[model samples]
Every structure is written in C-alpha cells, then in structure tokens.
Target chain A: MKCWLLILLILFSQSTLSADFAVIVSATSGIDVLSSERIRDIFLKKRRFAQGKRLVPVNLLGSKPPRLAFERRILEMDRLNLQQYWTASHFKGVTPPATQASLASVKLFIEKVDGAIGYLPIEMVDDRVKVIYEF
Target chain B: MSFRLRVIVLMTVLSLAPYIVTMIVMGNVYRDDYERRIRDNMTHELDITNERIEQSFQSLRKDMAFIASLDTMDDLLTGDLDKRITNLLVLKKNDMQLIGWFDVIDTDGNVVASSNPDRIATSADSSGLFSVPIRSSFDDNQLGQLTIHYSFENLDRFLPESEHSHYHLIVEDQQVTGPLNTDPVISVSRVLTDWPAVTVTLEQERQFAFSLLNSAENLFVIVLLVGIFVIASIAFFVATIIVKPILQLSGTAESITQTQDYSQRVAINRNDEIGQLSHSFNLMINGMQDMISRLKAENENRIKLAKEKDRAEMLQDLSTKLSRYLSPQIYESIFSGEQDTTLGSSRKKLTVFFSDIVDFTSTTDQMESEDLTNLLNQYLKEMSDIALRYGATIDKYIGDAIMIFFGDPKTLGVSEDAKACIEMALEMQRRVRELKSEWGAAGYSKPFSIRIGIHTGYCTVGNFGTENRLDYTIIGSAVNLASRIEGQAEPGTVFVSEDTQLLVRDHFSMTPTSTFTPKGFSQPIQLFRVISSGVTRSEIVIEESGFSLKLDSQELTEAGRQDIKTRLLNLIDDL
Candidate 1:
C-alpha cells in the first residue's frame, strides 16, 4: 500500500517525477535488439555483451523507484550489493553502470553514444533512444 | 566527219568498252561479296548469341545444382526447424545479381520454402524462369524442382550491339524478344540447348549488300569515266598528227580540180605511211593533169578547124551571089587568089563576043515590064549557059545583050579561044530560037532575032575601078569594036574582028560579014563572020515577011521533021 501510495503520489506530481522506467540503447546500437537475460548480465556487469556487441547499463537518478525495481527484478540483487559488486569490479578493469538524473540526459547520452544501454520510463522513451529491456 | 572527231570517238568507245564491262562486273561482285559477308556474319552472330544463352542457362543450372547440394537445403528439407533455407537463398540471390528468386518445391509441386515466404504456399509463378529438378545427390531421390526466375536485365546484356546485325531470342517457335531493329532484315536462327527451350536469331538490314554495291558502283563509274576522257584526248592528239598533211593534200586536189590547174603540187617531207600516200596521190594528180592538158590542146585545135570551115562556107555563099553581077571569069580570078581586088589594069589579048536580040528595044517596048523581065532573063540565062559550056567567060550584059571573052584569065591559046567563042555563039543562036518559040507559045508573039559580034585584040584585063568597088574586066578598043560590029550584023548572023578571024582561021570558015568604025579608034575594023565551027554541013534557011527559020540538015532526023510538022499543025490550030 505504501509503494502504491508512493507511485500514486509520484504520478500525481506529474510536473516533476514518474514511477515507470524504460531500458534503452543508442538508436544505432547493435545491442538494442536483445532479450531479458542479456539485460540482467549487462546491468550486473556480469557480461559485457548482448550478442557480440558491447553493452552499456544506465541508471536513473538516485533513489528512483525504477532503479530499485530494476535491481530486484532484472539483476535479482539489492542496490548496495550491486554497487559493491561494481566497485569490486573496477579493480579488475570493470566499471559499474552510469547514472543520470533525468530521462532527458539518459536519452541524450543514448542518442550520442554507440553501443550504450540504459533504462527509462516507458512514457519517456522515443526514437532517439531505443528500448531493449523493460522491468 | 573530221578526222580528229572520228578518231576521238573511236578511241573513246574502245577505251570505255572494257571499263564499262569491268565496272558492271565489279558492281556485281561487290554485291555478291557483301551478301556473302552479311550471311556469314549473321551465321557467326547467331552462333555467339546462342552460345551466350547456353552459357547463361548453364550457369543458372550450376547454381541451382550447388544450392541443391547444400547442407542447409538438406536439413531444411528433413524438417529441421532451426535451419533457414530461405535466408540462405536471399544471400545467394544478392550474391548473384542475375538471379531473381528461388523456390524450394516439394515432390507434390508445392513450394515448401522460398526467398519470398509470402509466395511459399500460393502457386509459384514460373512463367519465364528456368525450373531445374533438385535431385538428392546421395540417393538420386526425386527432390522437388527448384524454380529459378532469371533477371531479364542480365539476359538483355547478353544481346549483341551491332548496326548491321541484331540478336533475339525465340522460344517454342514463337518470338519472345527481338533485337532493336524492327524493320525488315535478313536473319539467321539457331536453337539453344534443349533445357532452355529457346532459339537465338540474328538479323541484318535488307539493304546491307546493296549499300556496299552502291559504293563500288560509284567508284567504278568515276574511274572508267576518267579513263575515257584521257584516252579520247590522246586519240585526238594522234589524229591531228596524221590528218594535217592529208587535209593539205585534199585542199590542193580540190583546187586543181576546180581551176584545172595542173601545176599545183602537194608538198610533204615526212617518211611515214601517210606521207607515202600523199606522195602517191600527188603523182596520180600530176598524171591526170598531164592527160587533161593534152585533151585540152586537141579540143582547141578542133574548135579552130570548125571556125575555119564555117568561114569558108560563108565566103562560098557570098561568091555565089556576086557571080550574078560580075563576070564568072572575074569571080573565079578574085576567089582563086589569082587576081587582087586592087585597082590596076593589065594588057592581054582576048577574043571578045557580043550578041543581042535584033530590034530588042522595039520588041521590048511593046511588051509588059514583067513579061520583058522574064524574056530578058530567059534569053540571058540560055546565052550565058552556052557561053559557060564553051569556056567563054561572060563579061557583061546590057539590056538583053550578052558580052563574053576568053584567053584572058584562062585560055588554051588565042586560036582555041576564038574557035570556042564561035562555037558558043552558034549554041547561043540555037538556044535563042528555042527560047523565042517557047516565049511565043506563052503569048509573046514578037519574032525574036539575035545578032552576034566577035573581036580579038590586046586589052586591059584586070580589076577596074576603086579598091572598094571594082570589076574584073577587059577594057580596050577591041570591046568597042565588038559591040559596034554586033550593031551592024543582020539578024541570025555572027561577025568577028580581023584579029579573031586570023586566030580562028584553022577551026572555022570565015566571011567578012561587017565593018564598023568605032568612036575610040581611028581606023575601021573588018568583022569576019563564022560560017561554021567544023567541016561545012548542009544547012537550010527560010526567010519571008519577017518570019525566018534556019536549020542544020546534019542535025535533023526524019523523026524530028515529023515532030516539027505535028507541032506546026498544033500551032496553026491555036492561031
């Protein structure tokens, strides 16, 4: 009920925030067309590919509900463990997924970058950014 | 025709004849060659197009066969769901640009898979594509056919590009596609391999052979025409060389024939055959001219002779007219070139005779003028005829008196001349009697009597008077004595001078019949009468009352007396 209430309150505050999110890639990414397991592997930094293309995972703003839902549903891990895993992966020449404060920045990054993978709200997704996976 | 023109025409004909034949032959040959070339080219083109089509079909067949042997094709046919045969076909179709599409057919003639999946279940359209059976390689099993639709764009690229020749495809004896040329053309065809079920045709324009022939004919005509002109010019040049001398010779010949001048000659200096001919022609002309000149001379002589003959005939007519006026002795002397017409007198001894009708003036006065003229002319004509017969040249006649002379222009001798004069006088008297009787019978009854006188003496005998008007005569006292003696003589009597009596004494018996004193002479001359010209014969004379008759009995016959009696009786009855 609290989660439903938070979702409603976030939706009711339409000018500022939203609950739904979208998984996207750069419009020209070879990695845009992929399935669910590959999406999970890309966000956990467990594998660097969907098919044979390089993968990119993007985050929403901190404490966004879509990010937590992505960690629980797609990664099947909590946010702190995912962060710890990414931090530990950095010493091995690995990096965690990047974060963007707004869907617009994420879309901007996706439109400008090649082989980039991210998630945004379904409502925010457009031709500039391609949706590869959804949670 | 002029020599140059003739020769030029001849040479032109001769030179152009062969060239014309050659031109025609070359035109025909060119046409034949072009036709042969076009036919061979068509045959070659047909072969090339058919080979191209065969190669195209073979390549398509190989591709289909390779595709049929593929593992994906086998796996897909055996129901392996993971295998993507249509995608493989898409890659192959893209690789070979001429392949339109491919269909994998099951044995039931159904398309199980295709590059166009929408076309898989629906009936496949294999209208113009090659449908090759895709048999399994391992078992020779009957796999479904693989229908391949070849791109027409690629087939079109195989067509030959030629202006003279074109290529086309014929399938099942029907024209499916053709070369760009649409008009009528010569064509050759060849069927391709049996699998393609098509024929390749090559076509060429109908006028191709003639086009080559046209160019050849133009070239032939140009060359032959030029050759004709050149040969004709040369022939004219040669003809000029030959004809100049011949023309000159002809000119000279024409002039000679026209003017009849034989002296003209044609000059030639060369030694060729024409020069020889000119020389020979000149020789013949010279010979002819010689003959012509000779004939001309002969004709001139004949004309001169003819003129002379005509002039002689005219002179004869003039002399005959003058003989009536002049004495016949004078006329003969003048015409015989013995006497000149100049007025000069000469003395010659001549016997002169004079005779007249007795009392002619009294008798003639009683007669009419016309009857008198007739009587005078008759008397003169009879007396002159006797005179001429006896060789007495008549001198003159004075009003019925006739005077004659001999021994002047021509004479046997003086004696012969006198005797001839006497004989002539006797004959005159006889003819006068006859004429008188004839005149009396014609109604003039005057009894005509004649008196004769003869003389001989030296007299001037020549042309007398002016040179323009002259008379050939004798003029002297003898002439006067003869006339006066005739006046004194009785009718029917003849008398002569003493000179004539002496000269004719041997030939006649003479009587001193009369004497006359002439005015111009101082002495009287005695006139002797001639009694007879020969030995005396019997004679009879009857004279009474102005009627007189004389008869020579030696000349009378019995029959003649009887005739005279009968004539006298007839005359009495008329009286």
Candidate 2:
C-alpha cells in the first residue's frame, strides 16, 4: 500500500511543475520580448525593474502546484530545496518573493498592477493580463 | 651550605624557572588558541561543505532543466503508459540511482501513465506535478501532469566524496514505503513549467567526515608546534642571560671564601653587577695575601733578632767574667792586642801572689767531699770576692792555693799593685777567721787558712806551654819567688818580701820573719809580717834584743818613709 502511495507522489511531483511563470503587462503596453536569462532574472527576483517599469513577482499558495512550478522553473529549485535556500538566504539578509492563492487572484493582480509577473495555466489567462513570456 | 650545592640549586632553579613559565604561558596560550583555531576550522569546514552541497544541487537543477528541454520527457508526458515506461526504462538504465520514475498525471490529478506506475499508484497529491487547472499554449482547456523522480545519485552527480548518499524517495502527500535502511537523505522536488515532465523530486544524503578530519588534524599540529617553539626559545634565552651570571658569581665568591685564596676569580668580562662583584672579590683576596705575607716576614725578623740578642748577651757575660779571672794587663794583652790567645807569651810587669791551704788533702778527707769542697770553695770564693774588692785579679787556683795578680794586662799605676797586694792580705786574714767559725759549727775539722806571697816584677803572662795544650800563666822568676814566699809563710800568716815591705813601709809594721837562703837564690831574702793593728804610721816602737825606739816627733814627721830612718837611728845608740 505504501509503495503505491510513493509512486503516486513521484508521478504527481514530476508532472505538476510551475517553473515557467508568465510575466503579464497591459495589452497595449510597449514592452515586447525578453530573453530566457532576463525572464529567469526577473522571476528569481534578481532584477527589481525592467525598462522603467517596476517588476512584481507573485507566488502561489504554499504547497500549491503553480508555486512549486514557479520555484522549480524560474528559480530552478524544488520546494523543499527552495525552503532550505530561502532559510539560508534569510540568514544572509535576503527575503523570498510574495505569495497569493488561486488563478483568479493571479489574473486580477496582473491586470491591475503593471509589470506584474505570475504563473497560471494558459486557459486561465485573459485580455486584461497579456502574457509577456511563457515557460 | 657548601658553594657547589648553592651553585647547583641556583642553576637548577634558573633552568627550571623558564620551563615553569613556559609551561604556564604555553598552557594558557595553546589551550585558547587551539580551541579557537579548532572552532574556526570547524566553521570553515562546515561552510565549505554547505557550499559544495549547494553546488551539487545547482548542477542537478541545471541537468533537470536540460532534461526537461529534451524531446524525450515530452514524449513520455503524452505517450501511452507502455511507451512511457519503455522510454523511462531506457533513461533509468542510463543513470539508475537518481531517476526513480518517469510518470504522467492527467489534468484531473490522476496518474494517467508512468514508467513506475506501481510506485506512484497511491500518490494522492497529483497537484505536485503539472496537474492543476492551468491553460496550455494551444487553448485554455488543455491541462496536464508530468512528474519525474530521478535517483538520488543521478540528481546531483557533483556530490563531494564526503556527501555520498543512499536515498529513499518521499512521495508528495504520501507515506514513504521503501527500505528504511536507505536513509540519512534529503528529499528535493522541483516543479517544471514548459515541459511538464521535467519536474523532479530526489532524495540524497550528505557526509562531511573527511573535510572535518583534515581541518582538525593538520592545522592543529602546525599551529601548536610553531607556538611551542617560539615560547621555548624565549624561555631558555631569558633564563641564561639573567640567571646564569648570578649563579657563577655566587659560586666563585663562596669558593674563595672557603680557601681564603686570592688566586681564583669568576671569569666575568662584562660591565655588570656580577662582573663588578668578581672584581671586588679578586681585590679582597689579593689584599689578604699581601697582609699575611707581610706579617710572616716581620715575625721571622723579630725571632732572628731575639736569637741574636740572646747570643750577644751571653758573649758579653762571658767576656766580663773572663776579665775577672785574668789580670787587667793580661786581659788587655789577650783581648785588645793582636797576640793570638791560641799562641803564647808576652812581657809585662805584674804582681803575683800564691796562697795555699796547709795539709789540704788530709783536711778534706775528714769530711764529706761535698762539704769539704764546699768549705774550701767557700773560703776561696770569699777570698776572691775580697781580692776583687781590693782591685786584685785572681790569676788561678793551684791545689788549695790562690794566685792573684795586678799590673799585668793593663797597669793602674806604679803603686796600685802594691796597694792591692797589701789590701788583699788584710782581707784574707779576716775571711779565714770567718770560715773557721763556720766549719766548727758544721762539726767539721778545724778550719784551714790560706797563705800567700806577693812579688812584683817583669813576667810573661799569656797562653803558654806545649803547642797542643796552653795555659794563661805568669812564667817568670817573679812568679817563682812569689810561690816561695807563700811556702815559707806560717799558717794563718801572710809573708811578703822587703820589696813589698818598702812599698808599704809607712803603711805597715812588720817584724821580719827571717832571712832565707834558698837553693835557687844567691842572696838571702828578708820578709816581714805586715803589722795589722794598733800601730800608727807616725811612730815606731819595737823591742828586738831589748831595744826600743822613741823617735822625736819632728824626725818622724820629716821622713815620709815609714820613719824607718828615724827609728833605726834612734836604735843605733844601742847598736
């Protein structure tokens, strides 16, 4: 019975990745393409602003799929490893990114805030929040 | 205590003092420094281990990203279960330890397909993979799940030798069911975005034993050895410079005191306190030697002078006594003149007198020899004392006789000898009477008397006779005549020649003993008894053949010649 559970965990953990979080802007915004390194730098909170617009990196609720995906793809780390990394980084005076819950909330925050970056499935995205890059 | 012991103690203390100090300081410094160094090394080792562990994870993430971009994971994501299992089996064969599974979960959070389908059968959290409500690039209705559990070793190939691990996969929101012995592991999960199958979860174990042992062992020995070397050398140098000299000076000073010798000194050349002390000690010893030598020399000189003084006093006494035994004229001839005492003879005018005890041998036989000798010596000693008192010299003792003289070695005057001779005769008579009474009291024989004869003329008085044996004697006719007169004299009386009488004619009243013609003499010699009492030099009265003289006072006074002429003239009418 426990073996069946470990296999499920392994399969689920490998599939639902949110490493490629999207950077959203206004549909009529002037910003266009960004390199994979630039997107990584932005999602990892290395670059605070891009092209005179303040970049906001949003996080999913704890233990959520997109949050884990965002950590693994953008920050290139697992949830447990990221927790350890953030704990060690906090000791060095660095804080982790902010978090929110639900795809609806991600879309609402992205439409209202310029240069807002968040992660959701492509179906949940809207005209109000234009996708700047995809994972 | 002895000098050597003191020195030993001082040296030992000096040597040990630094060692003790070194022990104290080294103990303090090494304990703190070693502890601190150990802690710092531990911290640095920990930091390096942490960094290496982080690097291992970073490399694993990059590999996972690359694998996610591979077309293989995408195919595994969308393929049938059999196909995905076959594909993952190939991937697992490539690196079996870390890549535990390759599975796919549908948008309903179900494990639709998997390489290890049995391993994920009970995994309830399909949201850990790409299984939540999310839009695909083609449309908002497309959602998928992709999950990969790489083997522990495959996840991080750059794990250091100290960080090798045996792992157990931990399923999300599910119980771990693998072998428990595969432990001491950390489970890591990554969420993938573009290629859902790129999501990975891994378990790894880290060990830091090698780095800790290296840091602790090597650096401790190096730092400890360096600290000990520096402290030990400092301690030794300090003890030698400060303590060694004190010991040397004290030892040498004590040695010098023991021997009281100035020859040895501490060999110090520096201008320091101990050096000065050594210099002073040398000076003190030198001074002591000088003083001792000076006193010794002076003491020897004093003893020498005392011995010489004793000899000189003895010589002076001998000379004074010898002068009393010899006539003055003879003494001058022997001592003052060049005539050798070992040789013989000198010509001079001298008076000689000889007196003898009558029947002296028979007289001595009646009494003890000591008493008789004492008696005779007593008589002689008294007579000699009188003779010296009268300025006469004792020439020699012949049997019981005494020979006396005057005017030989040195002369007093023309009449001095005659006067001494006369005074000696009077004193002898008085001494003999005293001895007779002393002998009678001792119950001995009747005392004996000394008879003496005197003559004054030229004689030889010196050491004379055979070459082998010599005597200092008067050897002239004058000496023989004096002897003859001594023999003729009656017992208890002194006889003198008319030559002696003429000299004392006014001084003496004497009846002639008789004329004697001896075998060796051609002429008869006349002698007289020196009148001893009740007679004045102014008048002479005597009866010889009924003759008496009453001399006129003027006639006796006019003649200074004992008034013999007046007395004879007054008696001439009867003649």
Top model number, TM-score: 1
Superposed on the true interface residues, model 1 gives a C-alpha RMSD in angstroms of 22.2
Per-residue lDDT tens digits for candidate 2, residues B1-575, read 74444444555556566755766576567656754664465455444544554565465455544444333332222333225334554464356454455445545555545556474444535333122222222112333444555443342443233334322333443424334435444444433233233333333342232345345545655755565565556655655666677778767768877986557766768898767876886687678778878988999999999999999899778878977766554565666654467865678777777889977887777777788778877887888788777777677877688888877554676467776787688668767766777778877755776666767677887777778876677788878888898888876677888777766666666778887865688998887876552246444333222243333344544455466666657767766
**Model 1, range B377-447, lDDT digits (tens) per residue?**
77778777788888888877777788789987889888888888888887777677778778778888885
Worst 10 residues of 1 chain A by lDDT: A10-19
- Quote the positional error of residue A115 for candidate 2 in Å: 81
- Docking quality (DockQ) of candidate 1: 0.01
TM-score of 2: 0.39
Report the CA-based lDDT of candidate 1 relative to the real structure. Answer: 0.73
lDDT of each: 0.73, 0.60
Best by lDDT: 1
